[model samples]
Target: MKKKLLASLITAMMSPVIYAQPLPPVEVIGTPDEINQQRLSKETVQSNVSATSDVVEILTESPSVSVNQAGSISGFPVIRGLADVRLDVQLNGMPLLSSCPNHMNTPLSYVSPSQVDSIEVYPSITPVSVGGDSIGGSILVKSDKPFFAPTAEQVTQGEIGAYYRSNGNAKGGNVEVTTANDKISLTYKGNMAQSENMDAASDFKTFTTTTNASSGTYFTSGTEGTTTDKDEIAGTAYESINHSLGIAYKGDDSLFQATFSKQSAPYEQYPNQRMDMTDNDSNKLNLSFDKSMNWGKFNIQAYAEQVDHEMAFMDYKTSKQMPMDTESETKGLKASALIPLSASSELTVGTEIQLFKLDDYWVASPAPLPHMMQPNTFWNINNGTRDRYALFAEWEKELNPQWKTRLGARYEMVNMDADDVHGYNLDYFPTSGSGGAGNQTTDAVAFNNAKHAKTDHNLNLTALANYKDSDTFDIEMGLARQVRSPDLYERYTWSTWPMAAIMNNVVGDGNGYVGDINLNPETAYTVSANFDWHAANQKDWGLQVMPYFTHIEDYIDAVVERDFNDDFKVLRYANQSARIYGVDIAANRKLAENNYGDWSMKAKVNYARGTNLETDDNLYNVMPLNATITLMQAINRWSNAVELILVKEKDEVSEVRNEVKTPAYSLVNVRTSYSWNKLRIDLGVDNLFNHAYDLPTGGAYTGEGNTMSINGIPLMAVPGAGRSVYLGFNMKF
Candidate 1:
């Protein structure tokens, strides 16, 4: 299907002969307004494509945002030090969920950076109409808008681009075509990418090991003993293809658009998880409508998405190959309207409904295990379903020339259910005396009789105010209460055995987990503020500072479930109180300029701290204080920049999991771009200094085919990518 779509796009581009006018110059990249929500323009997306193709990587350029990478191509976006279910990530207003148990196929993984037109980030305080059941914030990614001819004439426009990187021998290409007439427009886009295993810096350490052999360590070795490669990171290769088609109709007062997209990732290896994604395929269909009315503007959207995912071990370290298959389907609809109440006030109201279904199971494999008494198909989660209905209303009032305020509220009801599940033994495995092998006990009756239906009611509220003290200074303060229901896997997974529990972990902790049927929803109360300072002219310099705090009533956490053996432990999802606080500071200034070029300097610093209030323990996978500085120079149509990134050593680690501490490191990168008429070229060298480092939140190191110990500490953290040069080009016709 991918090949066919690519061929069709190529054929259409070749047959096009109607020459309209030359395409307009690409938009220039600039910093977003400090007082308003941040946005990443199309030019910024194009500039970063040389470094990475993933949309999540591009988002990291924004202040207070970071990425947790599991492989070269798979990464999860962390906003304000929050990740996973905390943030609402949407593509063109459509929400996407990960189908993999380990979250290898995140929402952002579905859209390539080349296909994005813009990205809007609502940091800390989000409007109720955007989404429900989130605490961190919201990220909305918009693809290129449909084009319609202004006059009563038909026109065609398109672009073809390709890129290559030397680090992983990576190569990819993208194609976009659009045909528009007076009343209708048709658009198609296709992208394909593939890469081999990525290499680390020459001096990078692969693993940590102990000198003494007498002490038996559980965390220092792999489940199945393996060796590691120091120069190349194992299980960091991937290949993917995606295609999207859109059709739109435009009128004087109303417009309608429909889009269909298909994505297929043949495989993506995860060095942080025990298994790798062998097959991942997804399909999305969305329809949206907008109309102008006397009272206001009305909008409506409906979408459906389906995903089929599979995972397995492709190496020889494990005697048994555990292959898992999972499938998810999501359908949703949202409608909203903006109505003007007064000249200084506007009211917005919206409602949303979503239904999700999931199935998780493992097929019997050929490999045999001596620890198990017998083998059978494991029903991890059977017919799991989650349904949500929400309603929201927001009012924005410009109380006076100096003060503006926004008030919003939302109510949501969630229903979750699943069928009875069973483990391979169809029974509870006891650690002590038992009828099963290895002194294990099995109780099939208990698991099969467990209840699976649950429901939750969640309500959220927001109150925000902006005060303008002067032309050059402004302050914004926001207070919000948000709620999030437990995911299906956290509420419905019924297995307690090691293998069954480990398959449900989303965090790359290399540990097994079980779900609790009676867990309560998480409710968070937050307070945030942003201060902006700039020159009166607004072009020479600017400064912005943001501070935020959040307290969660029933945050989901893991509790160790003891078994008979001392080498292995199982974790069960539980509720606990937690708190997180952070601050972000950024500054940009036009330093100097000459006849030959102009120069500017920009710097940003971010810090976050989280803790389990009840246990007084540090939160897991929290990124430490980091800072970035950049010097940019531009001359005519060419732009060049150099960046220095610094990270502080992580000393506050998770006590529950005994998380490893990452050493401090600094890196340098350089990038340049040039454009001429219809062609554009981008060149970049990442990690210019060839520094060896690891991401504090990169998750556990599960790299196989290597020894898993460095000194005394377990080498369980994924290493950052090594130095690499990339080159790319694009031509529009």
Candidate 2:
């Protein structure tokens, strides 16, 4: 199977060369950085931004990136089939931690697409200059910088934009104002957005309750259900607002900047989980300094952020509301310097320290008979902390005119600790030992008496070589060894029951999960290569092919424990060996130009597979093979495009978790934009054909108030959004 896939990839890469024709103008989406860095294009960023946009939406345009969506707004990016803590995501060069135990409020959820200037991506292999605590990949989101006037005279500049969409009745607006001079600059930005429940296609399938005597006639039985079409997706409404202020000072040889931001989200519902976000707020402050000297360049930065989050069961689901509160605080410092070693060589050295603290607890509400377990507050995690310190060095040199190489290394130390935690005892429930409030059990007592303190030491190394064989072709090869320590939630969640155990899950799998304190850090060794082919001018046509393989030691895997009952199995986090391999292909060509406009075509294909060597089972939630094609036309100030997306059926699923299979589907969309004077207008229709389909990586279905079985087996995935028309307007001063 692997050989056949490789052969098909090679055939696809060479097809474009054999059918060469008159090329059209090509828009470069990535700018080459030192060794393994790539910058997103302005056109690509603008095309994907909208009122209800997140960073994951824009990142999915890249060849090697995909997204796992649990709701309309809860989307997480997956790099080479790795996500969550395995990947490092930074906003304006600072790390942001999610306060929700379920990770409904991810780091990227805080930044709106309009506020982002550009994004730098490192796929599979990362540099030492960036932080070295992740094993998957790295993403850096940069905001618009303060502008300085050419002369001493002060200048004022700003922009305002608004957009509306029909699917969810979504509407939002953003505004920014800046006044600057050569010596000083000041800027302020604000945005607000709101949306209702999203509508799915007519044929979207969802599990509904039906009568069946053969399955023992139980409401929670998974074998007594059938699939049916649903129109509106439940528990998917959201509202958010954000504000930021910036100030900068520029001297002859030095520059200093400070920024402060605040975000408030009143509510965001998650359709793929049992709970919804009721309230979330965050505050951030950052300070940075840069100076130029005769020896080299120097940079210093410090940042801090705090988040407060609350979650509760939706009103339609249950009469009693169970509330969960969580808090997270993070502080970081980074300093780096570049020194010239020779005419063709430069060295970079840096150090970074990050401290994270978390507090999680829950309050149970009064309920009627059978379900009335406890009304006291439970301590999920008390004073949990994780600290990381790292030092790194990198060297980049031009060996000759056509050959270049980069070597880097990093050393990291991780320290984790937490106070004793407590939860509701099994004896407090009706099904267990005794139906009492204060009764204690062996499992709860053992967890409370357990000691939780651990430390890990890790080292990362990278080597990359690039050969500029000719003006139109380049070859790049890289090898990397990366390491990542277990997160606090994966090591300190102190519950073995269904309710408490399932609440700590971040993958939206709708299954209960318990943490194991003995998990070891994961280490990954990867080798990758990239081949780029372009026109002689490198502006008319282009094609890029990347292939990679990774082997991981002590990889995190979930084990099923069926000791509790037959209705559900408890999943415990454990360590094992795993392997992942994939290939990415992209091609673009400017076909021709006529009286109507200039025409062009672009296509992208992505494939990935992962397996655990210990259990010989497929990895959970792996994305299937997918492809996209776009046809574009450009006039003087107007541009139009149509897109076709295709996804293959996914059958290689995880047997341990009883993962579901998604059928193949295709979709079509059209969009157009026009700019006049200082204003621009955009109009588009998504899902033009109104095809009903389910996302392969959408996770399990947990729709509220729906007549679906609540059993945690034979998983039912959430359906994708239906047809929608949108209009947007933007103006500049």
Candidate 3:
């Protein structure tokens, strides 16, 4: 299978060269010429910014990057099949941590697409300068920088944009205002978005009622029986608002900036998880200074963030509402300097210190509640702290005019600990024991008695060489050794009770998970090679084929700790070995230019496979083979495009977790935009054929029914949106 896929990728890359024509160059954001990274083109970002509010969704435009569907705006960006905390995702130089156990408020969720000025992705063999405490990849999201007038006089400029989509009646808008002179600048940005539950093209479930014989049924909305419409996909509605303010000072050879941002999400329903986000509020402050010294460049940054998150079942799920709350505070400082060793070489050295504190506790149910949750607050994780200190250095040298090399090393010390924890109503289920109910007390006691603190010293190294064979061809190869310590929830979630274990699921797999403090940090050894073929001018056509492999030691996987009637087993996090390999093909060409417009085409294909060496089980949530092709037309002030997306059936399922398999599918979309002197209008249609399909990585559906019961509801894949027509307009002044 791997050989066949490789052959197909080679064929795709060569096809574009046959009909290539002169075109403009593709822009690389924030990346040097020697860096091996995938960048989103400005045109692509502008075209899709109005279609979706999800910031991570824009990552799909790059090769080997996918999204794990969750809430409307909180999709997890999957890089080379690795999702969530496994990847290093930074927003405006700050690494934000998700506070919720379910990862309901991901790092990227805080930023709207309207605020993005650039996105850069460094896959598999990432450089240590940009990667640390991550085994997979790195994503950098940067907003527009402070702008100043050419002269001393002050200048004011900004943008206002709004968009509406037919599906789920999604509507949103954004506003940006800035005032600047040659010496100082001030800016503000705000965004608001809301949507109703989206519908699928066809019914994907057999039963309308959310009930079964195993779990007792209950009345919903004052009715004896509740039914969901066949075409309606419940628990997909969402609403959110964000605001940010910035001020900057520019002086000769130096700059200083400060930014503050806040986010409020009243509700964000998730179809793949048992609980939805009832409320999430986050605030952040960032300060930075940049100076040009005699040696090179120097920069220092400090950032702080706080998150207050609450989760409960939405109206769609007629289950007992158990409120889960999480509060986290994060602070970090980073300093870096670049020095020129010689005319052909430069070195970068940096250090970072980060401290994270979290409190994940559940408010006890008051009187009249039947569950065992009453009487005492449940301390899932009290006074949890994860601190990391890191130092890194990278050296880049121009070996010759046609060859460049880079080497980097990073060392990180991670310390993690949490206070003792306990379940609710300890008196009801005494430590003496009762059977299923008594397990909670026993588990709590064991966890409380066990060691609660852990520290790990990790090291990472990366080496790369880029050989420019000619103006039209070049190849970049690299080797990397990366390391990542477990996150707070991955090592501290102690409860074995199904209810509590299930709430800690970050993958939305509808299964319970118990953490193990003994699990070792994951270390990955990776090798990657990229072959590039482009027009001599670097503008007519381009094709890049990259293949990579990674072997992970002490990979954090799960083993069945307990099973309830052989359904939805409670799994414990364990250290295991794993392997992952993949190939990515990307190409672009200028077909022709005529009175109709300048015709061009761009395409990307990604394939990945992962396996657990210990159990020989397929790794969970690995995305299936997928590809995207887009044809674009550009003339004067109007831009238009037609896109096609394809995905293969996901048959390599994870037997341990009973991961759902989705069928093969394809989709078509069309977009058109026109720009005038100060105004631009965009119109687009997604899923034009209204095809019915499930997201390959959407995970199992547990949105409704008796979600508290491990197996009360049938498992199914979350369906994709059917169709939507969107219109957007932006005015600049």
Candidate 4:
């Protein structure tokens, strides 16, 4: 089917040129305000395309950005000390949601690194115009845009790339093609990647089989057969493919564009969580129109998305595989206008509306003798819906030659509701007791009897100022008030049973979670400052330091609901006060320039801490102090670089969740790339020392064994990958 679709697209090109010259790169023009935010360099983005499949990894080079490792393709982005739903993440200016309960399919997972054209991060002091329904900062990602020929003559251009990695024997390839005239263009992109289970730098487990030690029972690992080796990370393997088609039209004063995309993944294993993703398929359509008016600029955008997701025991967790399925739909529309109020000032206003619906259910397990195995279907989240409507306005003014200021405000109305839910049975299988079945029935009764509808009126405000102190120094400060409403799962999940609760966890912690309908929206007040020091020429050396603090009211935190006296526990979401503070430093300098090449050095450091003010317990999954430094040499069309990564020991942890602690560690990596007129080749080696270390934010490892039982697995943090050598090549026509 994939091949047939690509062939059809190619045939529809109307016999265009097959190997025409590559078109000149497009130049982006933005307002001066855009320069205030930090952006990733194009070189840096292109260089890492062959090293990782996750687009979120590219943002780690920016200050105050971290990743909560999950599946290879679905790493959660963390800003400051918060992650997941707390951050407002956008792809191609559209906000997307993870349809799965475990978040196996994230927004970034849909777009490959090779498709990214530009990325920007607003670590803390986010502008109100760009922030909505989120307390943390914002991340913006844009895909490569369609290109049109400069002349009336038709033009055809494309690029094909392939890569291979030694670790896990990973391999993938990508292809992109564009055909265009002066006024219209059509483009297509497709990519697929797959890998075997990766191994840790050293053996971390004692046993090879995942069979339950206490019960002396074993099950096959999916259809693949057998158990994992001592050094293998059982559930780290994955396979995925993505395809997109775009069309664009340019008029004298207006432009219209549309994109259709699809994604399919047979499996994406998650070692940190108990369950693995068996299938995830999605389809999306996006449309936009932009016009240049005499008074201002006007734009409108509309998008729709649908996802079908399934989860079950895969890889090593093979005992009594339970099938869970989810279906979600999203639709959104936005319109904005930028008007110049004066020569030195501009007014920007926009309004947006989004509607989402979801349904999650689990089928009855195969007839079995196990006490917990049921004979009926389970309703997890039936007919769930969340809708948001928002309006925002911002004003930017050049107060004077040396200072500029911006003020903005936004209002959002969020409504959420879900139908009743129930478990597979009302009583224990063999005997009637106060166990899993009884608790499930009781929780279902209570949830059904109570109201499931909720509404929140949220407001956000921002005030910012920038001062150009001198030719070599400048400073910027800002204050912001942000608000975020809970997601459907946080407000509608209706079960306390350990097994059911564990399935709803999105943080990858080896724990179960229950939701509360009474939970309140989070409101935060933040203050931040940035100091920039640079050489007079702004090329030889540069340094940027940012510090920020936030106080949050009604923060969504968990409280122990059921303690099993073990590593895993069941918790209920509740509203509480919390605080977070962090600092980020980034610097770069020209080390030397000789016949060898122009040498340069760059470094980034980040440190953040979060505390539950009510209980004084540390926040879960807060990254430890870390830094990355790189040395680069460039000569002609050849580029080479070496990187060092350092991380501190994690001692502060969430007492309620029994979060694991990791020891300090460091690693080295090297890469070199050479380019010809129309082709490029890259070679790189990661974890050059093959060092053994635990990932501070990797959560608990439950890749295999009796994952169904809450306490069946041992307590341990996931280990980092071993050394890997990769080779890649790309050709353009």
Better of 2 and 4 by lDDT: 4
Model 3 spans > 4 angstroms off: 1-32, 209-227, 316-320, 427-438, 565-567
TM-score of every candidate? 0.89, 0.90, 0.93, 0.93
Candidate 1 lDDT over 124-230, as tens digits, reads 76789788788888888999888998788999999999999998899999999999997999999999999877878874554433222223221222223444456
Candidate 1 vs. truth: CA RMSD?
7.5
The alpha-carbon deviation from the true structure for residue 189 of candidate 4, after best TM-score superposition, in angstroms, is 0.5
Candidate that scores best on lDDT: 3
Residue pairs with backbone overlap in model 4:
none
Worst 10 residues of 3 by lDDT: 217-226
Tens-place lDDT per residue, model 4, 398-515, is: 9897889999999999999988777787422222233356386677777877888998999999888888899888788889899999998898887888888888999988899998
lDDT against the true structure, each candidate: 0.77, 0.77, 0.84, 0.84
**Number of backbone-clashing residue pairs for each candidate, in the order shown:** 16, 1, 0, 0
**Global fold similarity of model 2 (TM-score):** 0.90
Q: Which 10 residues in a row give candidate 2 its minimum summed lDDT?
A: 215-224
Question: Where does model 4 exceed 4 Å of error?
Answer: 1-32, 210-223, 316-320, 369-373, 426-438
What C-alpha lDDT does candidate 4 achieve relative to the native structure?
0.84
Report the error of model 4 at residue 424, Å: 0.8
Off by over 4 Å in 1: 1-36, 203-228, 316-320, 367-374, 426-444, 563-568, 705-715
Better of 1 and 4 by lDDT: 4
